[model samples]
Target: LLLPYLRNKGRSERVFKDRSNPLEVLSEKELLEKFRFPRHAIQQLAFDLEEKLRPETSRNCSIPSLLQICVVKMDFFNISGFPNVIGAIDGTHIRIKAPSTHEPLFVNRKGYHSINVQAICDAKLRVLNCVARWPGSTHDSRNLVNSQIHDAFERGELQGVLLGDSGYPLKPWLLTPFLNPETAAQTLYNTAHAKTRNVIERCFGVLKRRFHCLHGELRMKPERVCNIICACVVLHNLEDQMLEEPALEITEAGDEDGSGHYIRQMIVENIFSA
Candidate 1:
């Protein structure tokens, strides 16, 4: 009796079954629809991360990394005739469980608990940078201002300008649409900016679609939620996927830099005026 009890004590009661691998069974198109990544890219990503992540027998697991593969060049000029634009910047809100600490800080204008995720994307809809640590109550401009990319631009570490919505401050390296268009050139610039910056909205759509957890409320702690968002972003960038887009809004008017206005005017006159 003691020997039989000892043998069963540490063993799991659950039975194991051999499950068919989706990577092996599904077609490329089917894989893309369900996993939001092509079969080849999925294989490559798994191969690259094999050493870092180990599969388990029971509970699901996730791998976190900021790994991004830039298979194409960074160029946005071809889109909407926006000249010399490298990337589009914007902020999105991801819903999460209300934290026990400072719950009010997570309530956004929409009256929900969420994280304000700021993401920058190139013309290919690949995420170039993602900042997911801000609360939903935080403004989009504030997130950008506090990001490392902002410091990089200030330090002249990155070239080319970024297209953003009016929620962001206009800077020498970042261009925002004109609130009131005075000329055809300004109108044209706003049009081009809108068309070009639209990619970031689409990027959010694709990321959320690929990782359905982003579509629903993340039940984890705030810090873990942020890590999950970043991991999803890295996975999203690993594959070239397509999805829908979202709308934008205006906010915070007084932070525009003087040199930024000059640069916008120059671009309007030189590029769009024609």
Candidate 2:
């Protein structure tokens, strides 16, 4: 219901086994009568959230307040060897109307029609950032351009090594697998670091497994899509924050090699020509 839109979409999208839309339970008259929401209230809430989120210092405002809250609230992603721990980044396919003329935007490199949504999440699997306008054809590496990640890195606003699958390349500030070999020693070093970075992967799994709504087509304008995603992430983070569970636990038995470096390296090469 509106509660998911307002509260728990992030932590438990699949909490209800009944897949039927809850709104359908209402009769037609009730739907007509009750579907109306407080538009002024919504507008005021949006304004308040924007005020809390938008910066007074910069005219540039591609970022929204909810996303800004996600960034500021990233105190819980305990990525090893890194700090700030904002999120792990990746892309997902969202079904969309076929482009009227810009067919290439909908046609992904994988030979399908979809919109690519790049997202970042913290350690507890709450989405912290999202970019929705990129065509499905774009590579995750190339997609970073014109993105907040690009600006954040340029501004030195990002401090931690973000976690990702093999689809991203490695940089000093951004973490990825080895692009070239320095040695067996170098390879091991990267593997260990990457294992530490897999929290982002787990974050993706946790969110997707919970929110089946996100797993399907989301028809909305590009900007609204970004807001919907941020709202869900904040809602998810709120759930985790409410829970008293531990953030992460350290284990001491397995070899760092448990996560194959070979697979990770191939991901780096394919995702980034780096």
Candidate 3:
């Protein structure tokens, strides 16, 4: 009787272990399908959660776990060779009903009534900052220039470079690709910049896909529409998991710093030069 009970207990333990250890048996594609993320991402998640899931030794002696810190890894450099890129910034037009007061202001270059939503996102397509108040007629550069984030960057309150397109002016913290590639390094820099900046475009696509309301015209007041857009952005960030604040790399802001040009040149030499 004791021998049969021991065998049954061993079989149950093996079954439980096999059920819990899917990573060991699942292929990369299967892992992605099951977890909605890649194998490495799942591994990273496991690594991040190990401490939080660890058993507490005694009452009141357990270390407080910060589950939010798991999302801090930007890994933007992994996609493109560009270094220190914390965010990618871009503006997308959100179609909305014609406003009664500022109907003309809402008419975009595409001849559609829309709101120009400026968003900055991390490598993982998580929205870091979003501005949905600007009218469709506003230029992308103008919207960014008038935004609080611009002031923050100017004040050196934030760190890491933001990858933008030719529509945005280059700064110490904001990098745009070269229109005319004069040399091999400049060409390489442009290639990396384009690849890196493409993340913001993908981010916008994912956002619109996740929230189908954004694909069609929003039949509401501009103010209400803005609120909806902001809400969507917040939800998108929550889905991706919020990242920790990046460490600041302060730079002097004055007299339209031409240091951007110098910085670009240095990046071309150090990073792009092969």
Candidate 4:
């Protein structure tokens, strides 16, 4: 019924007898199995969402803002570590529609039509910032370039390296593996730096593994997909608060994040000096 309405303009509701919206793509049992939301309750929630999101169905709305309201209500804002502390940044792919003609616009170097969802997390692995919907075709560096991260670096709001995996380009604001040398000196230095910087990976692994929804098919628009990611991040922070896991690393302190002042401080000055 809804599918015909969506396909044909000005179709009268009288032609359809079933209350079931065909476009919903889920039966009551299926919704319970997949989303765990009670079918009746989710029906109302979906209606409310359409009312709020598609007031006119003409103007686009931001997914992050809606997610922020839900997240801000959770008591997970105070992520530990300060001054010398900031979150790490990294991107993960969420599957999406393959463009009809412009395949290159969606094809990533990783070989998929996905968007890069980059996030910054605090020492405790709670996300402080999330940048979603950057095209998969863009490099991690380019995503940061076209993101609020550059602005944060310029404003001196972020004064530390956003610890990342090797996919990220080396910059003062962004920290990656040391490329200078493979000799004894550089190898030891790289090992030490990797220690403190790997917190983001722990966060990412936990996020993707625990919340199965994040890894599933995103049927909505790109913006809604991003909102779903943001919601998951918010949920992660809330769970962190509830569980309060002590210092997510299993190894002793000195193994990660590299040696002290030199590398981390260099990253800080290089970026914050902006």
Q: Write candidate 4's Cα lDDT for 58-135 as tens digits.
A: 134222343333332222223322123344667777777774555577678878787788776655667666677676
Ranking by TM-score: 1, 3, 4, 2
Candidate 2 vs 3: which has more TM-score: 3
Task: Give one digit per residue, the lDDT tens place, for model 3 in 1-274.
Answer: 6999888878854343445678888888898888898878777666644532233233423221233222322467777778877678899999998889979999999999999999887777777677888899999998988876788677765656788898888789888889999999899899989988898999999999999999999999998898788777666665555464432211111223488888888899999998
List TM-scores for all candidates, in order. Answer: 0.71, 0.56, 0.69, 0.58
Candidates' C-alpha lDDT: 0.77, 0.54, 0.76, 0.57
lDDT of 2 by residue, 87-200 (tens): 567777665556556777677766776667777765556555666667778787777666756566546544444556557654444555556756664566456456555655
Q: What are the RMSDs of all candidates, in order?
A: 10.5, 14.8, 17.6, 11.3
Q: Let me know the TM-score candidate 4 reaches against the reference structure.
A: 0.58
For candidate 4, the C-alpha RMSD (Å) to the true structure equals 11.3
lDDT of 3: 0.76
**Residues 165-274, candidate 1, lDDT per residue (tens digit)?**
88888899899999999999899989988988999999889889999999999998999898788778756654554353311111110388999999999999999996
Error of 1 at 135 (Å): 1.1
Candidate 1's displacement at residue 73, Å, is 7.5
Model 4 pairs in collision: 87-121, 192-258, 193-258, 195-256, 195-257, 196-256, 196-257
